[model samples]
Target chain A: MSDLKKLGVEVLSMSVDSIYTHKIWQEEELSKMVEGGFPFPMLSDAGGKVGQVYGVYDEDAGVENRGRFIIDPDGVIQAIEILTPSVGRNDAELFRQVQAFQLVRASKGKEATPAAWQPGEPTLKPGPDLVGKVWQVWKPK
Target chain B: MGEEELDLGCARPTGGPVGVQPDQVPPEREGKSIEEVRKPMVSVGKKAPDFEAPAFYEGKFKKIKLSDYLGKWVVLYFYIRDFTFV
Candidate 1:
């Protein structure tokens, strides 16, 4: 989370569970998993009103499914991931996405990150000349 | 349909092509667009819907708003329920 913060990202987690449940879960379950519990806010979206907007709520089940959205500073969503309960999200991938988004925004769409691109890695410049020649510039290792 | 049969992008079993045969139209969903029947999915490149809700933070209950984090990248995620594994 500190790494996300360093990139100017704020994480807000929400669920249909009540605040009391959040408190209990954070104190008992999360605290044991992460030191001092979560550094970000755990929101209670009772009745799934907020989830309904994001398309994660299951009205029949009265619960929200797993969903994540990466919203840029302009309040526009940059990415959306909706998964079933059986799968867990990868924190490293999430962090990498945030870093990639930051770099893309900084470049104003002039540069694009390749698959699994990390900081200081080469970024592709999208143009007609670069087309069909990407293999010459980027080789997966 | 049972929950297990619910696939993410599967066409409604009231089958045939997406144009929908009149006889197979689900009564309640008749005349409704796919977007209306399904949950309102916010797509990328669209404005993130703003919401204000009570939040638990630092052992305290505080109201948090999505717009409050404007001018900063926001990782807004929704999980199934509390007390579940990550």
Candidate 2:
């Protein structure tokens, strides 16, 4: 999160735990991170109200699922990925996704990214020169 | 793997190409596209939910509301537990 802040990305993390447990955990885990310099806000959802609204609440497991939603500056959800309880999300992939979104937004609908694509790669425009032009510029090793 | 009777909603034999018969199509997939396989947990374009709850700021209890940050972009995330490794 601190690294992302340095890159000019604001992050807010929320939790669906009680205030007492939240406080204890913050003292045990987050205090060390803060001492080591972590710049971000952590919100508390004591009663699972926020989690219920987000639809990530799991009553059986008594916790929110691992979900990642990338909202644009206009508050529109551009991309979302929800993982099962047993799986964890990848931070490097998230960075790439952010880069991809930034590139697409910067292009202003002139270009579109292909599957499994990354930033600075060749983008294809939907026109007569679509596949042919893309293939010409795309050098897959 | 038995020859007694095989009813898999297919007309072809056991070793034939696997293809769905006209009547074998599940009712759920009758008129849906691949994009409609799963619905989003939350509506993307709708207004965000508002909440008035106790939040900690600067080591003190503070009241925060979703409406307070209406004009700006807010990323509201939810984790199962506060201190668990995510």
Candidate 3:
């Protein structure tokens, strides 16, 4: 959460549960799991209206499946991921994507991050000369 | 020419054109299968759908709108339910 905040990103979590349920769950379960409870807002997506738009709502189960969206400052979605209840999200991967997107946006699409790119790693400059030469600059172990 | 020798040129992959406006209801919503309706309305290059919902924040219940955070990056996530492992 702190890392996201450092990048000037705001996180909002949502589910079909009511606010009352959120209160109890936070006080009892989440607080113990994370110090001071969750740092972001917990939205009560009653009736799954919001979930329906995001395409995570499960009508038969009356619940929303796990989904995540990364929206840029322009209110455009940069990425989307949907997962089932049996799986958990990888926070590190999510953070890495956020960083990559930020770099791309800052560079105005001039730079493209390679796979498993870290902050200081070299980024690709898309051009005709670099087409087949990517192998020379970036060697995947 | 062999498959590797054939130059297709560098062209962006094209997706089906969006026939329905974001805010408008599709004319043939009923004809769409469950999978189609469940497809995410927003895409990477498209604007995210704006919404307002009740939220619990800092011990207070308040209404929050997606537009409120327009000037900052947002990481919106949905979980199956509360009190479950994330």
lDDT of each candidate versus the true structure: 0.78, 0.56, 0.79
Q: What TM-score, computed on C-alpha atoms, does each candidate reach?
A: 0.80, 0.66, 0.83
Candidate 3, A35-129: lDDT as tens digits: 99888877878777678778888899989998999999998999999998989999899999999999999999999998888888999999998
Instruction: Kindly list the per-residue Cα lDDT of model 1 for residues A24-130, writing each as its tens digit.
Output: 99898888888888888888788676787788988888888889899999989999999988899897999888888999999999999998798889999999989
For model 3 chain A, the run of ten residues with the poorest summed lDDT: A44-53
Candidate 3's docking class is acceptable
Question: Looking at model 1, how many pairs of residues clash?
Answer: 0
State in Å the error of residue A61, model 3. 0.8
Over the stretch B1-86, how does candidate 2's per-residue lDDT look in tens digits?
Answer: 01122232333211211122345556877786432322233566565545554444444444455545533444455566665665
Please state the CAPRI-style docking class of candidate 1. Answer: acceptable
Q: Which stretches of candidate 3 lie over 4 Å from their true place?
A: B1-39
lDDT tens digits, residue span A37-133, model 2: 3234455565454555566767687777776666655556666666766667777787777677767767886877777777667777777766577
Ranking by DockQ: 1, 3, 2
In candidate 1, residue A1 scores what lDDT? 77
**Scoring each candidate complex against the real one, what DockQ results?**
0.35, 0.14, 0.33
- Please give, as one word, the docking class of candidate 2: incorrect
Residue A98, candidate 1: C-alpha displacement in angstroms: 0.8
True contacts kept of 2: 0.35
